[model samples]
Target: MSGTLALVPAAPGKRLGAAVLDWLAPVAILTVLLSFGFAGITSTRSAGLIIYDTSLLALLGSIGAGLALVYAFAVATVEGRSGNTIGNRLMGIRSADKDGYAPGLGAVFLRGIVTGAGILLAVLASVLVAVFKWFDAAPLILGPLLLLGTAWAAVVVVSSAWDRNGKLRGWHDRAAKTLVFDVVNGRNPVATGGIEGPYSFAPLDLPPVQHVASPVASRTPVVPGPVASETPVEPLPPAAHAVHLDTAAHPETAAHPDDAMDRTQVRAGVRQDAPEAVLRITLDDGRDFRLERTVLIGRNPAPAAGESQAQLLPVPDPGRTISKTHLHLLTDGTGLWVTDRHSTNGSAVTTPDGMRTALQPGVPAYVSPGTTVHFGDRTFNVGHA
Candidate 1:
């Protein structure tokens, strides 16, 4: 990768705002139900007092309580499965685990229970007080406690403002073992790595690792020559001129005649047999690759079933901005086709004429030799090698 995929912590203000939004739907539902129920109360004031439709209020309140639980469950499920609730999406933030993945249903549910304990308990208290007439005076004791818990829940969510870790992890986050992420301005983890490092991938029928060698290795076998092969050898493509070259000026001559010829063949195979590549791709990190036919480019890519002929081009991306199999690059003698591999950050190409177009996922777009293809935090220029 050329630059870093910097992760920005979700700000305290944003988290608190999201929390409020996350709870808004259920709160609004319960409030509306309770308000309508209370408004329907009938009264007889002749005895200097009023009599209310207690049974009807209790029924509506109980219904509201049930609906609240359902709403809570729905919100938690959405957040757990996708790492975003309506509120989190609006705040441009999401909750994730340490490795930057969505915390599962259990964690997200536990977090909701802990963070929303106050309001939930208050609702339960009301339900209990209404369900049992014997607890008619229960509000005298429950009211203060419920109010205090509500204030405390607010404090717990806002406590992230004082978090020293800088990720705004509050008590609820700790209980859930989750961290909130800034998605709008930071790296978004939609796909895990399949090349290397700690990541899981679905079973893909991939070929052996033979293709990981240099591009030239496919057409011409490359023997692993020692680093000491710095001894100058004549750049002869054929053996007709190899025998007449200087024997003393080159180190391979000190050996037997056959050994000299063998070293010459090894040197020629190692450095001189590279085929003329149709497109030379220079990655942002300064490493270049010679694209001949089909090549899979990603953080760690492999040739799946139909792609047996393609080469695996592994890109070192610690931040995981690039997906496991990010893009598919296929080149003819004079044409190039780039297909985005359902990547998270998406891919694009800027032509030599300065026009930029975003590539749709799984669709191959034809680009000229001067076009530069950008995938995630990295880019490569397409040219003749």
Candidate 2:
């Protein structure tokens, strides 16, 4: 509830700057290559082929325009919508729905199609005018007009940054109800807004939307796997990788082997039933914690010292002892463990080296199989079914 207020507004100017940089690089490179090409054409005369002509300049112009279109559409629409493209990513900008969720693939495809079409149309118009001049013997005005129009369109696309809300606008942004915003510190929570003008509506406090490194629940069903639910759950970081412990068949199963497949096999073959509980922890990494099979241990029923002592989840299950302080236990056939659901005294974890660390209420601790977990002097060893 109490935190600093910062707005992650979109930087339309930065994005446009990046695009212009990208556009110029290729043009410079192509000009160099074309210069060489033109020299070769003049230096060597070949009867077998139609030698170089001023018309070739028109061909080069078309090629340049086509390249520009492909670059813009692909980078802006496809990459921008899904993951920030090279330009946007380098510029520290991201795109999302008016509500602040990731944009759908449809948005990406639409942007690509429209932007690409615009680029090509502009170039084709220029080419047609040139051809007309040759045939009709008219003044050479149409070509410049087409070029100017195309450049103006580019300007429009880039100017979306100037919108009051700091959101980008394009064909896809309008159709898919999305916009781009800067993810200052990677802490986007929710999306809320409207779609008007070019950019989508901005949320009151535009937090940087965080992304899950691992796959979460989603609407589209993957071929064979878990569907990511829409809940705001962040993936566990590698540092927090729970050391696999088992409490199934034996009290002491050897530590996991190097081979992942071998470890999976060993875990599947052992381990036992675990306690049932769900504690939601909102971590500093902007992820919601959903833990199961954890046991809270305390005698006085108040959170004990060094045990998770804050926001202890109230269990509704009638079978278990009901109290303000509870222990959650989970067994993966290997080890039974508990995590502190924010208790007052804090959850204390016994390290393998025989040292105990206070598991703060918001933090989680792993209790190895058969390891004596002491919470408020109430010692309990992991048990199997």
Candidate 3:
């Protein structure tokens, strides 16, 4: 599980939507074929029984059927290689095997066989009418078959709704050992970022700001006055104490008068020049960065409000593996927090002990030193500088 990212299951609606789009070409072909076949049948109602052998309508129907066959093969080939079809891309979703890769030709063909059973049933009936039956299959039989086939196909599309494993696999998906994922909200195995359009983005969840009311009513004003000769001062803060020499408080230091520094100056210096801890980001691409302020890192990262002047680390990726604004990294004295910028392939953090957790888009998560952060195909190790 070195770089594994869990895929979120696609919704039933999205699955149905993709199926509808996938079915379009085949459906159109079938519709044209049936119409031509039916026309051929009606025309030869009073003609000789061998009319189909020379009928123009029968010839057109045969051509349409051939197109349908070709369409299926084309779709299977594309999906086998990319795990996406025309509809899957538009819906911002895809089908993949357990390792989140294209399931290959065998699985894709198997899936097509299972999911297309109903559609092919209607096509077969049309072929029988156009060829053997000489377009003589009754409308009563054809109508009901077509209707049943349509309904069955639709059922197959949304069958994942009834899946037992949290509705993650449809019947065809299970048969092919593939899984459908909501790429609009999760990692896209193919790329790190892109609005695979026709699908809405998930709503951004910003951290809620909690406002604490100041106790103004109970506060008292201090008057300007001369201090008593032996005025009692407030105890020094831990940081101030660490930076100062208080001989009066620690009599043992009185022997070294030369070591005495002005306590007030020391306290003031600590307050003004407190050191902050920053991070060193070491990329797998052999780039090392140690920036003090907020940073945006990606292929072509740009800053946002308040960070308009922030550091931009343009990753050297000719393949565009990372998003335009893949990650937002901020360092305070205490630690570092990273935010995923809604990249398509998503991002994740891996602990020193090898615990991997996916990062939610726009959500900040604290990372410890010696851990690795991954975005797209690139990975970077975080460490204290």
Candidate 4:
């Protein structure tokens, strides 16, 4: 871990919410695509004997529009919820302001717009190029839009990779002054800290106030009383013998200093600071694991070429290279999930049959986010950064 301090903008495990939202996006897109495809096919069939080429083009355009809407919704929702879109999730990417937070809807919308514009421009450019090729004359004017779209896409990608956090600062996060925590361990640091030590107060005595007399009054000394005949004072009785106290007399007091310390401080300290384990997931091979930090949830090793703020961390101690031992983090458009990337350990899952059932390595298990993941002697969890 780098010694440089990584400011924790928000409590840890915030990205899990956005991950859930991202997971839902693909399902939503799939629904939209299938519906649109079916509808387009039906409409074209109903208008049979018409210009087949134009009809096909119209259907293609409709599909393109549907795709654009999916992109817009996916990006907008993720940006709104967490400051990045589904593309960011799938690509292990994110976008945020200089300071991380959930960027406002406006920033999300603006990012969506920028993304949409780029796609639109790309499509337009491709069409223009096709036209120019067909005409064999002066190239179409849409070439510039194509170039602009390409440039915009490149810029966004680069900005994300190069930014302080692995994020593309969109209008929403920027306007809202929020940033994104790209890789989250899914455990709440505040909760962790609370489990460790919460703010508390105790009472202690303060010094008493002082008093003074008037200088004149103090200056005048009183005359001593007339001397009286001195009588020999009788010696006091022999000092009382030391008394032993019974245990019952001091039930509240401890028998030893260490015991006192343990009662007063050790017990209180345990109540103050202690490590908390969140969730435990069992793999197919009867091996149970705990969540940890600095984990890679996505399969991809890199972001787009121009992704500016995209941060990359090398896999530390790729342990136990089992047959089905790879792992990936995935967002189900609502929450985050840690999944086995088809490792040879057989990705065992604890089944209701009270036995470990081997699942496909690529399958996912709902390991708690921000939770420390413990695997054999190794542990993975997110910390500051």
Candidates in order, TM-scores: namely 0.51, 0.37, 0.47, 0.31
lDDT of 1 by residue, 303-367 (tens): 77899888888887654668779999888857699999877568999999999999999999999
Whole-model Cα lDDT per candidate?
Answer: 0.72, 0.46, 0.71, 0.40
The true-versus-predicted C-alpha distance at residue 316 of model 1, in Å, is 0.3
Q: Please give, for residues 257-332, the per-residue lDDT of candidate 2 as tens digits.
A: 4434332212223467666532333322333334344334332344456545432433231111222454555445
Regions of candidate 1 where Cα sits further than 4 Å from its true position: 1-18, 21-26, 38-110, 123-149, 161-168, 180-213, 221-297, 300-313, 328-344, 360-371, 381-385
- Residue 302, candidate 4: how far off, in angstroms? 43
Clashing pairs in 1: none
Q: Which is better, 2 or 3, measured by TM-score? A: 3
Total clashes, candidate 1? 0
Give lDDT tens digits, candidate 3, residues 1-385: 1123434678899988888898787777768766765664433343544433436556776787788779878888888767789999888888776545566779988877787777678767766765565344457667888788787767877899998888878888888888778888776655432322111221234233333332332357454444344534557788766645574678765556533332222222234665677677777855567766688998799887778878898875433457788999987745678999977568999999999999999899998788899887779988765
Q: How many residue pairs clash in each candidate?
A: 0, 49, 1, 67
lDDT of candidate 4 over 1-385, digit per residue (tens): 1111222232222333343455356435543553454344322234454221234334654575667567657666656655446544554434444423344567666654554466566555545533333322313444466467555644543343444643334332354454444334221111121111111111123233233342333455454444444544354334412112444466675276444333321221235654553333332223333334323422133433453333332222222222122355543322336555533222333333344444455566653333443322233442211
In candidate 2, stretches whose alpha carbon ends up further than 4 angstroms from where it belongs are 1-7, 27-82, 112-118, 126-143, 158-172, 185-385
Better of 1 and 4 by lDDT: 1
> Candidate 4: lDDT of 281?
32
Q: Provide C-alpha RMSD values for all models, in order.
A: 13.0, 21.2, 17.3, 22.1
* Model 2, TM vs. native: 0.37
